[model samples]
Structure formats: structure tokens, C-alpha cells
Target: MAKTLNPSFSALYSYRIGSYYFHSNNRLFKFLGSRMRMKLIFKMNCDISFLAKIGDRLRLPHPLGVVIGAGVEIGNNVIIFQNVTLGSDGKKGKEKSYPKVGDNVIIYADSIILGNVKIGDNSVVGAKTFVTIDVPPNSLVIGNPCKIIIKN
Candidate 1:
């Protein structure tokens, strides 16, 4: 959205605004976002649900492969890189609960924050990390099985 001139900030702006409307249970807003959602998804290579409660200034520097679930709750000032998946397990029909991300967290590229997990505030999740458990606040986590390397 930011990289183009023809379809510029207006599209991205509309998407964010539309997302707000969709989150507020307004059909018009849903329609607006639905119209631009796929476009932006294709543009940025990401899928962020309108139902996902995102706080102020959620930054996506690189948006590719980001799959945020409907039930996910993101905190303020969170910086997420590419390939971050905040979602649930493969359970159909039943109500699924996504992750609850804390404030000031930095989730690096290719990190999977999945399935009812809570990423604590001020935490930093390293690249290619696969997280399936709750993370403590002010911690630095890395690795596939996931290791808590440092806790500030």
C-alpha cells in the first residue's frame, strides 16, 4: 500500500478505517473492508482479521505471511515482521480462541504464535520461533521448541 502511487495511502487508509467499522459490527464497514481486504492481502501478502482486536499503532514492517485470527487480541505498539502467524490449531466447527498478545512486544519474522497462547508484554520473539505456550513478560524467546534466553 505504501509502495505504490496509483493505489496509494487511500487504499490502506480505507482498509484500516473499514477494519474499524467491521470490528464495530457495522455491515457497511464489513463490506468496505471485505472489498479491500483481499486487495491489500494480495498487496502485502498478509491476512489480518477485522475481528482481531488491534491496539494503537500496530506496526507491520513486513506483512507477508501474517495470519492473524479473528479472536486474537493485540496490544499497543506491537511490531510484527513477516511470516508471523497468530492463530489457532486445526479444529473445525468448534469455537476457536487465538492468541492474546501483550503490549510492546516485538515478534520477528517466521514466528508462529499459535493456539490459545499469551505472549507477554515487552517480550521479543526471535525469527523462526514456534511458540505454543505462554511467554513471561520482559523475556527474549527463540528456537523451534522455543527457549527463553533472557528475561529483563
Candidate 2:
């Protein structure tokens, strides 16, 4: 499939390009990249910032309404579906308060992960789940308040 044909791919590429340019020391590239990122925010409704530390092969099945906060850290091969929000809580301190997603994790549609929570590797977050605590590795999380099930 052509990269241009896939909206998911387009979103990722746009993010990659914008991130690269935004991080550049050159002022002109930073300005252009910031412009592109703004366009992405308005057009695609994806509010991922260049400050986010996302690992390799991050997949967004449906990119719309996905908001990844500036300090969120996502590990490799993570899959995030539409309407998912990974953001920070109202708690203010010197520490980083955003959620950290582990490798090979699948965050289903409409899930909200907030605060200084750590999602363990190879876990699955069910659709519409709200998570505010640490999830263990190889677990399945589901429900509004979030229930953690240890997978064998």
C-alpha cells in the first residue's frame, strides 16, 4: 500500500518530519516544522507534540482524536487507536507527570491514560478505559476506573 494512501502512515510521517525539523538548531526549519505541526493539529485532530518521546514502530490504527501530551513517553511497537488520550493530571511538581506506555502495548479506542502512570510492556488497555495507576507487565486492563488482569 502506498504511504500516501494510508491516513495512519500520513500522520506518522508528518509527525516524524515535523519532529525532526522542530528539533533542528536552524531557525527556518523549526518555523516550517512548527507550521506543519499546527496544520496537523487543525486538520487531523491529532495533538501529538514534538516533545513526546515515542519509540520506533508506533502504530495509530485510526489517528483521529488522539491526544498525546508533550511529556508522554511511548515505547516501541505500541498501537494506539482513535480517541485515545495520553495526558497529564492536574498535579504540579518538578517531576514529569505524563503517562509512560511500554513496548508492544495496545491501547484501544477512547481510552484515557493520565498522570504519572506507567503502563507495563505487552499489556492491552481495553476501549473506553480510564487508567490512572501503574499496570503490571503482561496484563490486560479494562473498565472505566481500570481493572488490571494478570495474563498467564
Candidate 3:
């Protein structure tokens, strides 16, 4: 595939392959996948967890500095730019939580979504946005404090 050969898409390819192998029934394959994930973390600076569930047509335009934490679920047709983080609120508790991103979402660069937030479908999160609350569907979210605009 062209994605496999494209240098710009190397991080996405590695993540996809590692995710596939991590889900395999074979333990050896899981180990290898974990190693590959580690390589992706250390070398590529993209910390995408194998535990995270991602849907079809996920696009990472600039994969560097992207951190997707464990238990994060992303829906189909999501585009995430560079330095975007979807993770927990850094709370210490028995129950761990992460953000859930819906379908056809565009997360711009330097955006951070923390806690058990839910980003609804067909939403656009603007650059440098910080989201701690749930985002409604068909909305445009922007700014550091986050202002929501319902799309027509």
C-alpha cells in the first residue's frame, strides 16, 4: 500500500500494524506489537496506546507529539493534527477514564481533551483548544476556555 511506503504516514502505519498485532490471539505477536508500540513512542514521539479503540479512516496529518491515552475511543473518519492530546484528567483512582471522540471529528493542532469527555460527531475542535466538558454533536469548539458554536 502507498501508506506503508509514504514517509509522512510512517507513524500511522506503525500504529495500525501494532494495533492489529496487539489484538492477535498469539502472545508472541502481542509482545512484538508492544515492542513496536514502544518504538513508536520513543522514536516517533507518538504515544498511541494499543488499548485505545479506533475506527476506520483515522487520519493523522502530523502525527508527532500526539498522545492518545488508554481507554480512549475514536469513531470513524477522524482527523487529528500534531500535538493533540486525548487523555485522562490525571486523577488517581481505581476507575480510570479517557475521552471518547465521535465520527467525522477534526481535532486541530495543540488541542487537549482531558477526563471522561465525549466529543460528539461532526464536530470541529479548533487549534489550542482545551476541552474538559462534553461537546455536543454538530458543533464547533474553539479557544482555551472553549466556546461552542452549533453548526447549521
Candidate 4:
């Protein structure tokens, strides 16, 4: 796993560096720490902290205004759209509080999943929704207060 910083490669390669720097100690870390790696991600108009626990196949379709908290844990096959905020529930500073999204979840644009809520597997969070509570599995959550639309 010797990844050299290729000068030819642009900032679009941030995901590889962002995912790698967190869980391992390589030449990448020696060259660039978490802050620097996250900086690259920020350049892509997303603020996903390297401290956040992100699973495999994490796709950010429109990465702009996507603010993922340091405490957030995103599961596999998660497709997050633009202006999505996976962060704390207004608990002020220095708090380990955020959402834990499950696998195969499709979070649409401008949605905000806050607090320590656990979104179940195969769930779909609708656009511009404000979620602060735990959602059941295979459900579709929508609206400001979040209406649970159960899916089979």
C-alpha cells in the first residue's frame, strides 16, 4: 500500500487519500495529515472530516455543501446528494454527536440528518428533510419533522 503522491493526479483523487489517511499509517500521512487531506476534500465543495467513519462505496454525487461531522458513521453503498448535512444536533462545540446511517441508504439533496440517530438499512431520506430521530429499516423518511413512509 505504498501510494506515492503523483503530481499528474489532480484533487479529484481526494477520496482515496481521505479514506486512506484515517485508518492507516503510511507515507501519505507523513506527507499530509488529516487536516491537509480534508482540505482537499473541501476543495471539492464537501466538508467530510477524515475523522468520520465512512464505509465502502460512499458516493457523493453532487458533493457541494455536503457537511459530514467528525462523529458521523456512514455505511456501505450510501449515496449522498448535494447540500446534505450529516452532523450534530446543535450541541455546541467539541461534541461526538452525529448520525449513523445504514447500508444501501439513499440520502437525497439538501437533507439534514442530525444527532445520534440511527437510520436503518435500505432506507431513503428524502430531499430537504430534517431528521433527528431513529428511523426503522427499509423506510422512506421525509419532511421537516420527518414523516416515516414505510417501504416493503
Error of 4 at 82 (Å): 0.2
**Per-prediction backbone clash count:** 0, 0, 0, 0
The order of the candidates by TM-score, greatest first, is 2, 3, 1, 4
Compose the digit string of candidate 1's lDDT tens values, residues 87-141: 9865788778688999999999999988888889999999999998899899999
Task: Give Cα distance to truth, residue 76, candidate 1, Å.
Answer: 0.6
lDDT of 2 by residue, 95-145 (tens): 658999999999999999999999999999999999999999999999978
Alpha carbon RMSD to native, model 1: 3.2
Off by over 4 Å in 3: 1-8
Model 3, 1-152: lDDT tens per residue?
97666533788778888988999999999998998899888988899998999898889888889999999999999999999999988888658789999999999999999999999999999999999989999999999799999999
- RMSD per model, one decimal: 3.2, 1.2, 1.6, 5.0
Poorest 10 consecutive residues by lDDT, candidate 2: 88-97
Instruction: Give the TM-score (vs. native) of candidate 4.
Output: 0.80
Q: Highest lDDT among the candidates is held by which one?
A: 2
Model 2 regions more than 4 Å off: 93-96
Give me candidate 1's TM-score against the actual structure. 0.84
Best by TM-score: 2
Error of 3 at 32 (Å): 1.0
Q: Residue 142: error of model 2 in Å?
A: 0.5
Per-residue lDDT tens digits for candidate 4, residues 39-70, read 65556666777678888888776677888888
